[model samples]
Target: MIIEISAGAGSPSEQIRDRVTGLITTGALARGERLPSVRQLAADLQVAPGTVAKAYRSLEADGLVVSRPGSGTRVSDQASSVSPALARAARRLASTGREDGRDLEDVIRVLRAVW
Candidate 1:
């Protein structure tokens, strides 16, 4: 799973939590799939281990993931995925925006305005 941390966005922990949540809900991370260990993801993201741990704790609190001593973290079975139709529409929007020479910020701004 790829998680990007934007300096101008929320805190590193929040960004991690939100990104992982999005991945789970969009079916990018399957149910019962193991997430990177706290240390591993922290090293990958260049954040502290505590940051990834905090995000994992938040996800656990939200019932979106489960963490065990030996198993690491996995998406919870109850973590519902977004409908395929909605996922398709999102991909379509992203593709169309890129094809139209629009940057991510531009597409996000339009999405925000529409929302």
Candidate 2:
């Protein structure tokens, strides 16, 4: 929920989207957790409200979050449940790779190649 927007990054909306997605996928934002209001987040990030709205819309479309009138936005309970599980699996994989003596860069390279 602590998003730092870099001026040198891509479009503001894209940066917002990427950060939110990363948080969800890494299990930092739990399912059903409410996100800051679009206006509030935009003000905090110094971007237009529309930018945050666009990012929220994108996350909604991707099944990563949900927004309801009066309730604001929250992580999607169903889809988000899968993200933490996937993150846990990834962490286990990384741990096993390290135990097997694989360097971080090599593990990253393998992951990228496979991906």
RMSD of each: 3.6, 5.4
lDDT of 2 at 18: 84
Error of 2 at 10 (Å): 0.8
**Against the hidden reference, what TM-scores do the models get?**
0.78, 0.72
The residue ranges of model 2 lying beyond 4 angstroms of the native Cα positions read 81-112
> How many clashes in candidate 2?
0
Q: Which ranges in model 1 have alpha carbons more than 4 Å from their true place? A: 90-115
Clashing pairs in 1: none
Clashes of 1: 0
lDDT by residue (10-101, candidate 1, tens digit) is 89999999899989888999999999999999999999999999999999999999999997999998998999899889889989999999
* Candidate 2 lDDT tens digits, 78-115: 75434567878778878989899997678888889999
Clashing pairs in 2: none
lDDT of 2 at 32: 93
